[model samples]
Target chain A: MATATIAGADVTVDEEGFMTEFSEWSEDIGSALAGQIGIDLSDAHWKVLNFVREDFQAQGETPTLRRVSKVGGVPTKELFQLFPKKPAKKMSYIAGVPKPHGCV
Target chain B: MKRLLILGAGTAGTMVANKLRPRLDERDWNITIVDQDETHYYQPGFLFLPFGGYSRADLEKPKRAFMPKGVNLIMGEIDLIEPEDNQVKLVDGTTLPYDYLVIATGTSPRPDETPGLDSDEWYKSVFDFYTIDGAEALAKKLETWEGGRLAINVIEMPIKCPVAPLEFIFLAEAYFAERGMSDQVELVYVTPLPGAFTKPVAARYLGEMLQERKIGLEADYMLEQVDTENSKLISYDEREVEYDLLVTIPVNMGADFVDRSGLGDELNHVPVDKHNFLSDAHDNIFAIGDAAALPTSKAGSVAHFAVDVFTENFLDYIEGLPMRGEFDGHANCFIESGRGKGMLIDFNYDTEPLPGKYPLPGVGPFSLLMETEANHWGKVMFKWMYWNILLPGRELPLPALMSMAGKIPEKVG
Candidate 1:
């Protein structure tokens, strides 16, 4: 287990820096995680993250990339632009959800 | 009684084994195929892994499952080949002697060959889609990716699936468009070739596709090193292309054991007679697929076609008869252009891909060098054909050689 300090609070992260618990996830933590990966979150980024978080709470699993675009009302290209390098993992990381399976 | 030992039970090796099993008599002949692992990957499926359509199970199966019942399958690391002694030494201290040896150990992506390519940011920032792991990793990356400049680069040429990088860019364009963030990602195709593709006619056609898609073309760019610290590709000619995310197809080289055996070229490819695939250095050895230094694309279709010719020639060689079959270097590929549209290209060593119909003269279910939905379906259906018919050594409706029947002759300029 690895721990990252975001806004002076310790959050548990997996080996790949993915969040270990949803309870530790906050908008501020998401912002800090984004800063570490060299990105600044926008409203659009928040919208996707919120959708993923809500979807996870309701469904008990990370939302598929396709569902985020098709049902979550975000387009695929914008989702990519928001997450940059790796949208699915990065989004799951910031959203404080378990890393998506079958993603690697 | 004699033995035929094959190295690397991959695409070419598996096909050869299946095709030869029924032809060779068990009482007088024994066939053995060796590979480093039990898993046989449908490599073409790797290209689709980054996208949603294909799954991991769809691309992989047990190698022995596809191998014929009579052929012996040995899974171990290959140490060296002592062709003069008619034997191969395995890392586990197993020595297998063969009367005829076939090397089908294919090419692999060598990211380490490029400086800083395998650095700290490998799966984090820089990525490749050539391998299953790489594709899966990229799939995770693409999930919430806010795009910037997406640089799709090829380190060098003679790569397996030469058109794959182009296909990636096309699919990326469509993916971005479908996601409604089309304006966010700027697609750039960086290649060592001057145009979009290797063939002139195909290059012209594919080049237009890039242009129409608004993807930037950075042609004739020879990679020198990956500036991982800065997230940019610095070419040998001092050209630099910055990117937010780098998707590269690294330098592909034949297996290292080929180099150790002293029977390979500078790139570790075994030099073979282009027609019959007989090793230039040894009469009893033949190298097929990406291992052979054939003057054609390093593609599955080429391996399939070559196997068709080699099957006949190989039977004749062991019987002390002159080989009559000459491989014409026939190859065909379906290029996915996204939006449920794709293109087909069929050519050989002597011919370039021209605009025409395939398998028939006037009417074709598939068109060549032109994008069509039918071509995309053909591209999708090929996975079924590859596993069920092609690997089992079943006969296909297509010919092994390129035909001039439906092709339009090049007009004099």
Candidate 2:
């Protein structure tokens, strides 16, 4: 892991730039992380990101897109529209949580 | 008398019973195993069923035959697992109480969970090789298939025997060639993973094999639904892969009783301490096998290794002592690469599968991460071992924890 400046906040990140510390995140920091990955945070995007953040806080792991829709009251089709392709990875990167491990 | 109640008489449940029975004295411990059926499927055999390699006799046996002679075996569908009362309710109105509960119902393909998957085209064009019926249907389909684009899609990750889909494609590649129709068939391996597998070295090794056989790899696909009307797979991101023969591994979930018990994750898998398979919530409840949300492959190899650790730790737990075993998440798989050639992979939680001789350093009868004829025989011989040695709880020479002794570690891996 390495520390980097994102949105002018010091944060630790893994080799793939996924946030190591979930506590080092704010709405401004999330937007900066989103901007780096070419995503603009709309209310729709925040709707998904916020759910992922809160759910991860509760479940203690990154929630899959299916869980966000099924348990968090968001439709899967809309998540695709908001986070676009690769929502699982992109959402985790912006939400400042560890990316979901490809559980073998 | 103290009671030990184990649910599901599949690979894990059966193994747990056999391992614990001889150790837990009959005078003091009363062990009872419950399941919905009597037939114990040699699940690893299911992969070869599509190729007409085995019949019902070779793949199945009575669960009673393997019981350790002292344990009680109950057959009935589970209605609910009442963890609070420490009892399980069967659909037949029988309630079996236990001092300790082991949930090992395992996971199964839930095609109905996805739209249009279990519909009109099921067993007609779209198929799944995870079940006996599906494998038999696929076998018949292959017998006279006028080949076209054959797409093997994995609907989700953490599916049982994750290598089976790749093995299916490999066997299909060789099977079509033997029929003098290699050109007539187009094989595509579609998965949500970015490559042939989750691990780096194995994926590269397996990915290269796919390229050599001229099979297409469609990766990073998370399915939204199966479009039965058009005979195609529609991904969540609007990507589409049209196919003629779709062999899909639909979303695999744990038993419904787990969900009803309010003791499961989103996928209905019981949350547990990974090292010991102890329930995160209730102290008396433990879930082993695919029923537990383990971070490793849900293959029989994992169940075997995990059961070994759980058995030892369980012996201590009942005595009110701390579990001394820290399970390393050891798992191995034999990948059938067709034409009497297969590959072996061995690894644990901290390590990815690497190339080396397995079980013996520089002198393995079977090799790891490289396809060979010996590996194929190892897989074939494993069936005999599974019935005679593995499920019966007889000791195998192999260690429960993974060792790097035979492995040649490399930076690239």
Candidate 3:
């Protein structure tokens, strides 16, 4: 099992590689990830996060990478550097969605 | 032997003074209004100023000209409000005692609250349509602008006429289109709200309208500061939104005298009873318009309706009767949607804006939440009504209270 501590909240990765609790994920994680990727979690980032969450809630599914890239103005390569995996999974993480299987 | 002192000879105070002047016995009660400026601005006309639809002459009138004949209008800076003595001191060290005090100092645009917003780029790159000066400057800037990315940003919530920013964008789009430069401009609406508006149905409808007009919606954008040198609006988290032209609705604060008087909240807005418009800090003190920390939208229509209710209650207080809670937070706004079309919204504390005919119900000349040319015309005509009818304290044909009679209420599933 892999465990990640974000903003003093322990996020545990189960044997199947999914986060146990999504609500535990904090904005600090978004900030930390942004720092790691050499990006700032700015008004623009929150705007994108809110938009993605809204789109997901409306459509019952995550938006494609192209749509997020277009709306967020963040390049796909930059997004990958921030997420390091599936964009949907990263969006889920950023948007505080419960981790799906095979995502650490 | 009660003396009534009204502060600020603006829309709200003027209305209060005029409405009560004839009602109160001149020999028994004395009324005085104090303000620094002599000019009364038709604030709604500020929106049209940026587009050359209005001028300084069209927007301003002598403060005393519109006031009631009997009400004493004193032009001077307010030094402080002495709640204990029930008197307002002027900057000249003169004190006027009052049995009842009405605070209508209104709100001010504190552009300095946002870092670098008031820098050299202000009215050059960053502009606000909320002020007459800002509007005039923006007009000149827009005239020569070749156009690129234009962003309308709201720093925070509880701004005057919450929909004015959206209206500005819509009007700008229409303005550019009229000049055949619409294609050269990329319009973006940036706000701290979760969507285009606060109300759910209005937000959804307004969001769709933005999409239709090809306007970008940057929601939940909490502005941390303005990077004027870099031409970027930076959020608290450091996200940067680049813009060629920034139309900002700055942080609005109540009268500074409120802070000096120790009678205001953090934002300097007076704490008042939501329904009755009576200041909780002092029994004799009342607040209306942008000065009061009311839950209603800080718009002219809200002030008009509130003063209407306040007029009734103030009369009762004079007669030594109990106050009636008649104000329902009734707000009516005409939202311009561009291309000679607009939408009218009427709602109150309990009711959300519903779609249907307005005023006349089934046979209304105006439609609510639905865009129509007639609504746009109504909005345009209001400038005249504001000066001729509303400001003079004349009785309007329509009721001050919000009516759901003509609206088709949305059924909640």
Number of the top lDDT candidate: 2
**Residue A78 lDDT (model 2):** 83
| Backbone clashes, each candidate | 21, 0, 1
Which residue ranges in model 1 land beyond 4 Å of their true spot?
A: A1-104
Each prediction's RMSD over C-alphas, in Å, is 20.6, 1.2, 10.5
Candidate 2: RMSD to truth: 1.2
Residues B1-413, model 2: lDDT tens digits: 99999999999999999999999999999999999888988888888888888976789899999999999999999999898899999999999999999999999999998988979999999999999889989999989899999999999887999899999999999999988999999999999999999998899999999999999999989898999999999998889999999999989999998999898888998989989999999999999999999888999999999999999999999999999998998998999999999999999989999999988999998899999999999999999999999999999999999999989998741
* Lowest summed lDDT window (length 10), candidate 1 chain A: A95-104
Full candidate order by lDDT, most accurate first: 2, 1, 3
lDDT of 1: 0.88
**Candidate 3 lDDT, B151-178, residue by residue in tens:** 9999866789888999999889889989
Model 1 misses residue A29 by how many Å? 70
Q: Model 1: what is its DockQ?
A: 0.01
Fnat for each model:
0.00, 0.71, 0.00
Scored by DockQ, the top model is 2
